[model samples]
Target: MKSACATKYEQIEEPDMANIVDAVLEHEADDRPAIVGETRTTSYRDLVDLARRLTGGLRQRFRNDEDVCLVVSHPGLEESLALTLAGWSLGHRVAVLPPYLKSRELEYALEQCSPVVTVSDQTPDSAGSVAFRTLLDAPASDLGSSASEAWLETFTSGTTGHSKCVDRRVSRLSDDIEQLASAMGLSADDKVTAMTTALSTTSVLPALLAGSTVVTIPLQTARQFWKAISDTSITVISGTPYAYEFAGRKKPEPGQLKNVRMALTTSARLRPDTARRFMEDTGVSIRNIMCSSESGHIAYNSSTDEELLAASVGKTLPGVTVEVRDDAGKVLPVGQSGRICIKSPYTATGYRNDPDSSAAVFQGDWVVSTDVGYLDAQGFLYLTGRDDHKIHFGAAKLDPQELEDILLSHPAVDDVLVVGEAHVRLGQIPVAQVVTSRETEAAELLAYCREQISATKVPQRIEFVDKITKDFKGQPVRPKYVRFD
Candidate 1:
């Protein structure tokens, strides 16, 4: 199941579509380190050469037009980036296995992607996975195509309760780079570090494609993440709502990250209080970016309008069109929440081998991945929750993210996941699975929730523990409450 080779740019009418990697390589003003790690600093030239070597290595085991599973566990960030781009250089689709993927999940992904070769740290027990050293044996050549012709296959959580592989071309990825770069004004001059799960489109690829240096800490030791930023004079930091909350409360020593200027939060709800607190403590501004892996960024807060600053996900980036539509697919009026549909070259082609799932979301030129939000009169987007995540409490409906955001605002709460539990009297009730800091007590937290949101939105049960479970990519998985199955 290999993807096709390069197609001419004219074949696709994608706006802002161009070879971003070529642009970065040719136009970058700094020859100094574009990627820095604990032991080494990688310059633009080093990245290019390393990618060339890796491409040559991959060519030995697989043809120019094959897909490969990159089971990267390199200690250095520069090495990881080199391997990824090298696969693209050779026209191979790179499917990254999560750093902490269990044996069974890893096995399933390998079978699905059907990589001809596996580029891994240590050869897995699998008979045919290729070794990293093997890829190094071949010689580098000027690969024929630009990055726009290459692609990566990211696995998304499916409606069938399993993971589905989503095919995304480099052109699609460049669309994201454009938005983040335009909205945040990211430049080569900025040194960014993201403390999110690495096997994500936002955390790794977009930062690299933007030509900004990004630092990644493995998911296994996420607690030690601040050290990565503290050591480097990171200019930009991106993470989930949980990450921002944790960092804001902890307020890591200013000396460790004195140079940081921006903190961007995505993939979860953003709290105005949390944003203000983080900025005050760290001397950095918090920016909210609204997007999904299925659909690229539709809007981002421009940091101007206070109300938009308080609730909305900002404005649409350049060359991106966002529409709020009814189930009938009619465009809705401003300030009315509906299905969010986005048209961008950055959105995915479709979920691979899952036409039904693809058809559920892909509508003509736009793809709607169940985000229920609306644009205000000023065009700022306010996201409620995914349509799939909506739950009924008594006769009232609630979005889990709304409850989750409120729970996270508590000073003693470190992390929280709000899930709907089936009830005999009510259809479903919200339950909070909380990971707390030192001071938060379950009963006190319940009182706080009652004070903040409506009683219907309050958690019917508060389960306090040391940790909240997350997927291999570090996205929070709903903690199931089905006691009897």
Candidate 2:
């Protein structure tokens, strides 16, 4: 019996399979802003010329088959984008390293991909690396087609452990660009505010392919973020829940974000309160998007309803099918919570050089996500938590996200993480590390949790911290908590 997930990639004939650079070069006469940075803007013509020069530089430094890793030290820069497009144009596999990874994490990434050439903002301590600026000095080189199987290698967030390198082909990316652009209603006149890092290529690439000018902003602070949106006349924006949480802190003036038609959130879950508050202040709806590194864009909340946004991750996108399955892989009925498995044309082939992990997750055409979720009767998907994150407390299983979400709803709480702590009596008990506002007391927080959730779900120990450490994906880094003797 054939799996319902199995679907062939719809073949679309085009002059170029590598869409980004090809589109820019072909539309050089169009002379519109392709990339807008903090200090300057790159017109489509300029972008094409820059890519040509960079391709020449890359060709001089490395062979066509060699892999190149882009470590984006400086976020929202045109250099990173140029180098990436150039590598694709030259038929070399390009790996984009996450911008927020620490030194140790970066070392791990280098070991995993082991690219022949690394383009970075800072001088890499490792051999066979060059500064990004040097690429601009190279003379223009002859343009070439992408390699037949050339891939864009992206690493997982490594929050759980070491990141895995997921290799997605250029053809797959090209197909996704069209699908996403059509779904998002992107057009040539739109100005997209790219709040995500360079690693989030889908966020920026789809907009670029739609002929929209991408306005890059440093999402370091709320003030800077709002100012950028206001100044750039941004029509669309994509970011994580953490960015919106920061935005919720400041009240925007009337019509400040009026130009923004859609505000998309991904990477981390967005709390209902955070969405409602943001909508109240900015008059823009916060749409939660559920996606993965392996599978491109899976589901999105298309509706502007705040209540729906808070409850569900929205309906699956066109050409994407989602199913909930039990432990034995039998499909579960709607509203029955189980593992969330996705079947999509845009799913990546497999992980690069990690067959064991690939075989574990990717079964035939379906990418069996580690996330646990359920589907409503209306086809709306509600993510419960990660399957691995479930805590076995006595005989009762508890999801930490549920407790964390309840705690996050409190007015004084800034951020919170709930993890299992070893207990002699119960085997493991829930413990919460919270970052709160100045006035929020530990006792008050505990009382609030007691009021919200069941006794078993409540944290056995509550410790207040200055801030919660997060990985590149804005997910809480699980800490090695002190064991109670």
Query: What is the per-residue lDDT of model 1 for residues 99-174, given as tens digits with 9 covering 90 to 100?
Result: 4444534565665555535556676535467667666768874543345457777665411114566677766676
Query: Largest TM-score belongs to which candidate?
Result: 2
**Once model 1 is optimally superposed onto the true structure by TM-score, how far is the C-alpha of residue 268 displaced, in angstroms?**
1.9
lDDT string, candidate 2, 1-485, tens digits = 11222233334232333366665566666778988887788888887777778888777777765556544444545666667777877776777654554454456666666554567766553466777667657788866555565667776642212457776777667776767677789888899877645645546888777788988777676777888888889889887666676676678666668798988877755667777788777778878788787888888888757789877889998778999999999999988988889888777767666777777887877899878888999999987766566554653446677678778999988899988876543546888898887676678888887776545456888888889889999988874322222
Pairs with steric clashes in candidate 2:
none
lDDT of 2: 0.71
What ranges in model 1 sit over 4 Å off? 1-12, 16-18, 27-31, 67-76, 124-127, 143-148, 158-161, 196-200, 217-230, 252-258, 389-485
The lDDT for every candidate, in the order shown, is 0.64, 0.71
Candidate 1, clashing residue pairs?
A: 57-135, 230-256, 300-314, 301-314
